[model samples]
Target: MAKESSHAVHAAGAHRVVVIVDENSNPFELGCATEIFGLRRPETGRDLYDFRLCSPEPRTLMRDGFFTLTGVAGLEAADAADTLIVPNRPDTDVPRRPAVLDAVRRAHARGARLVGFCSGAFTLAEAGVLDGRRATAHWQWADSFRARFPSVHLESDVLFVDDGDILTAAGSTAALDLGLHMVRRDYGAEIANSVSRRLVFAAHRDGGQRQFVERPMPDLPDESLAPVLAWAQERLDSPLTVSDLAARAAVSPATLHRRFRAQLGTTPLTWLTGERLALACRLIERGESRFEVVARRSGIGTAANLRTLMRRETGISPSAYKARFGPQTNG
Candidate 1:
């Protein structure tokens, strides 16, 4: 039979979590679900998610000729789920099965929260769940996704898009961020922090995937920009300029601008803005005593400047960012 069935064990009123895994699915995405919902965490004293792995077809799902997954629940399980998670699709261009699309539409109609990671946004888009809604996918597929789903508001610059019940994350690692955000939303910030500590990842990364994209590696033997970057990082509290950086690197200002454009895909000023924003985020996450101090340390100079830059980059004020990631103190 194409539809094999199973039930998710809803633990005495826990939300039912259904994750749809297809052939050639990457294990990292599956691991994200397992780590966030599958693992038993009695220490947190909160309601846990009852996770179910379902498939549209009955045959075993294989990855890399090893690690075969069997006994996947059927599409019917998705109808009963409180949350439906769609990991990256096998291929973004391939059309989703009609049965799968129908199931997804039904689940969303029933008020189930829909989540898509990376290329899986294609599935949601096909099901019309993301129509007229803001969404994101891996940067590499952003152009294709927008072209295919023209009705959806595609945001390629963000790490994730949380449109109430429908959430979509970008790339592989960004899925983890989305999962943690879900945990924080359902449980609380404390539980999310604990999970992050257990995983040994930063509680939150400020900005978006734009900060991590690969650029042409710099190509100077003796006058590399690494030393200049390191020096600038150490003196973020001081007002620094591109001319100062050029002088430090012992290169002319025009040469420095060319090197930044060629190697970083951005101008020196743009990169400096990102670096300053990154610093402010770190200080906020570390529980800085004052926003002014953080602003000074990040070279933003004033609290208003910090707010403007942070809002421009993350769509949130510095105080809100701090509240979400700052240290917790018990009274």
Candidate 2:
């Protein structure tokens, strides 16, 4: 608890959300906040967030050479917000203004959640909010972040890390995942899924940043594993093993392992598990009611197994997840 008195709470029905913007703020990160929380969505019957784009001073904020945003709120707006979002800051080397840092500290102290996307994580770290807290940012900046804030427990491999109140996400599109997660937390998985579907994106992503990273091309150009992967994806309900995959790929088990390590940066089994989890999550989002059915379709085969796996990956039971993501028919 830091300073609870300064933050603003939404009126009984509205969700007060604020995004801090500055000169040279990346429009995409700011847009991620606005698009998810600020956009007007009437179909879901969810109370929209009372969104504000704020700055430390009253002035025009220029970005991307052509777009100029003016008449924005001041730092005090962030201090008063129920949720404060810090989008990407232009320069990590620039010292955070004392006023901005104060606002962040006060908001978090009062139990308001704080979020930083991409370089915004640096700002949270500068404010001392991320000290001893596990967080992440763009992998490219991982070294500098560690050097600048040695006390922070930075994990760069994951797309995002949700540690209850304060959360941080990696670079770029990962912000979408982080924002969707916030929606899932605040409202439920149902709202999050609806929002994602509106955006025409997957409700849940597989693996983490590790999957997106570019690696040196493998020495062998093996189109062999592609067919096996496609086949396995079609029959997720069927139990599959490395030997089965290897046989389908027409490669020795050792070769399959090496190929997977070289091309996917993970073992075939791990990749399969991630795919199954993704499938289960999608089914949950689509309003599937039966845990056993979801388990079977996702290849977990049993509700018990599905619950164990979902808990391990998301820290929530399948029923709880469905409650969050399923249709809001009753309401």
Candidate 3:
């Protein structure tokens, strides 16, 4: 999935964000939509989004009988939105209301950006918006998702997939990550960081962090790859090659490659680079100002190499990154 460019900032007040709520929806996912987009942020010094909630049945929608949501707008509201977010459904197999599916399809047909939180991807898939496009959902539903929608590229690993106009988050918790990503694309890093500070979370988590949630942590002690992964993480500053990783795991490079792909859905090198980048972010957040120092400490080797890698991975320069997430910003 292609990320929307951060360099092209949209004008303030131009974006309309609509949340589609229904029976059996997850309230936490709905709250994620509202908290990220509905709330007004004066700190941004510009309007972020005109946000509202809509329902196929406008009066009230009960989420699993745990609570009730009232005062939601009707389906017509989606037609006016620049973006439409579909939160998780109670059961992936249960078909959505015909009107609900129609609203989603119409919104997409009219050029509105579509987003699915967790099992909400099932809704989009049922509506035919996700056909032949890369998407994701709650990891628990991966097999059923593939069985039902074979045409959709189900990337079970990763927090979210940003397939340009249509985006799908892996799980409900990852919804915030995807939302902040949208904010960054619409406004810029500085504004997105401000929002993250308010929320007490990182401004961004690379989408590549997606992994199979079921076995994210190794269960078997002796036979587990966790020890080997921990060993490599502790020594990212060293020139650790595939052979080195294989040796640490006491397996051949070929076996290690298969294990990494089977367990993590990513190559060993890609995972290592993500870890190194994460370390680089921490150094930047800690007020590390020297690019050379940051590079050596993060194990990217040199300042020039760090700059190139950081930009390619994050779509922002290191200095600009520091400006938003550095320790000074915390104060």
Candidate 4:
């Protein structure tokens, strides 16, 4: 989805993503969607999603009347979306528009992807679409959401919950995390990396991570793993172990594990494996046909191991991924 968007960005082959904004809606989360899906990315020099914004009324007063937004698309635009983002509001108690709720229900019935950023989860729940599905919202709204929709499984502590087609984010910053995650799902790790770099943001934060830090963070530079992470990324094809990373960071393996848990919300082995798998994906999407070559080049050990890991992580075989995202060739 590559398009220069002022209000409506158009790209013929890109996935269409539309955001619905309503009265008292928070513009920050709306802007997060625009930045991730709407804006043209100069990083990969391609657009990842064809994006648009819509409102139920001509002039909707934003959260606290911070601004009155106008001149965007109408609520009917929700019907055309490959993915529909419900209105995100700060005042969780304020009732969502029936039009918005109906749009969400229609989108759900049609199997279009649905997203709820921050308190937008309430909108989805009220629409009756989030029932029996795992979701999350701003932690502060957790109690209220559960009390209102006891049928919906609400996990408030995580950054976001990805329950297949329907997803929800925890807070405003988590909105960015979920957006980049969606980009990663639609495109690939490489494109998502480029976009994250352009945004100057962390590339990946697993959705299972806590919304708030549980422990005191150690100061960077004095005992930072950035240098070691950089070193390992450059040499992923090498036979490196947790001990190797620990040694490079000038810390014991136990200490390194603790830091990875506290700082990155993941273990060292998982992070390393994900990086290697991402490298394999990049190689395959770039036209590497030999599975053995991809495995060796990505330090995934062997072709069988590569296939196993690929299926476990991405739920697709390398060949299937190539067929979906690979460069096209004409006969």
Which is the leading candidate under lDDT? Answer: 4
Q: In model 3, which regions exceed 4 Å deviation?
A: 1-12, 211-331
Say which candidate scores most in TM-score.
Answer: 4
Give candidate 1's whole-model lDDT.
Answer: 0.74
The residue-by-residue lDDT of candidate 3 on 1-331, one tens digit each, is 4435332223454488998888889888888888888888988666678898988774555666877777879888988878889757767888898988898999887777899998999999999988889998888899999999999999987889888789889866688989988886565555777888988875666676654533545556655767888999899888888899999999999987877766666678887887787688677777789989988988898989888988887667889878766766545
Off by over 4 Å in 2: 1-14, 42-48, 63-66, 184-194, 200-202, 215-233, 242-268, 278-290, 322-330
RMSD for each of the candidates:
7.5, 4.6, 6.0, 4.7
The candidate with the higher lDDT, 1 or 2, is: 2
Compose the digit string of candidate 1's lDDT tens values, residues 54-130: 98777645556457777889777888788898746547887877888888899887778888987779989999888
> What is the per-residue lDDT of model 2 for residues 249-275, given as tens digits with 9 covering 90 to 100?
888889888777666656788878877
- The segments of candidate 4 whose C-alpha lies over 4 angstroms from its true place after superposition are 1-12, 42-47, 214-217, 329-331
Ranking by TM-score: 4, 2, 3, 1
How well is each residue in 1-331 modelled by candidate 4, as lDDT tens digits?
Answer: 1111111223456689999999998989988898888888755656568789999999989998899999999999999998899998878887888998999999988878899999999999999988888999998888999999999989988899887788899977899999988887777777888888878998888788778763546676667668899999999999989999999998999999988887777789988998899899888878888999999999899999998998877667888777655665201
| Per-structure clash totals for the candidates | 0, 7, 1, 2
| TM-scores of the candidates in the order shown | 0.63, 0.78, 0.68, 0.89
Off by more than 4 A, model 1: 1-12, 63-66, 206-211, 214-331
